[model samples]
Target: MLNNWVDQLNNTRAAAAPFGEANPKMLTAFRGLNAAQGSNGALDAKTRELIAIAVAVTTRCDGCIASHASAARQAGATEAEVSDALGTAIALNAGAAYVYSLRAMEAFGQMGK
Candidate 1:
């Protein structure tokens, strides 16, 4: 029963996060693209998983992050790699959010009370 409930909830999440709703073709294409990327010989398994983690972090996607991080660990991403990916995400996020926030601050200054 517990497993069934978990499966249902996971299905719900997948349905909710469909690619371009009402477009089954696009969703199919998205799945194909992911499969190709995940299994391509050009990039090792570890590299692909790291990329997934980065995507998860960038989108602040808890579900994706949890899923990808678990896969990553299973596929041999060491603790170091996980930590490094997180650090890289944090650094990049700080810069990204900072650039926008800094501009907003400057704009606010221009608005003069």
Candidate 2:
């Protein structure tokens, strides 16, 4: 079986504990940000998680993906909804890549001058 992402998250949290302990201010700030961002107000938990998952994919963060995906599941997101959200992520990634490739091509052209 593949390595469990939840386990990976647990391990990362364990490893990060020392840093968090050593940097109380940073940890406090992080906790505050997490609480503020994670709260469900106008948007439901599931929707917030879906947005998080999409951003995680766009940012290419494995930890965020695992954490948010798990949260999405716990918040009553179905497999189909998760799949659809990922599909949206995939499309956005592709579009971003295509747009950035134009900048890459421009840079390459400038380098020859």
RMSD of each: 5.0, 1.9
lDDT by residue (tens digit), candidate 1, 48-99: 7887888788887766776677778878999899878888888898999999
Among all windows of ten consecutive residues in candidate 1, which has the lowest summed lDDT? 1-10
Residues 18-105 of candidate 2 have per-residue lDDT tens digits of: 9888998999898799899856598989999988988898898878888898899899998898889889999999998999999999
TM-score of each: 0.66, 0.86
Q: Report residue 36 deviation for candidate 1 (angstroms).
A: 2.8
Candidate 2: lDDT over CA atoms? 0.87
lDDT of each: 0.77, 0.87
Task: Quote the positional error of residue 106 for candidate 1 in Å.
Answer: 4.0
Which candidate's lDDT is highest? 2
Instruction: Name model 2 segments beyond 4 Å from true.
Output: 38-40, 111-113
Provide the lDDT at 48 for model 2. 91
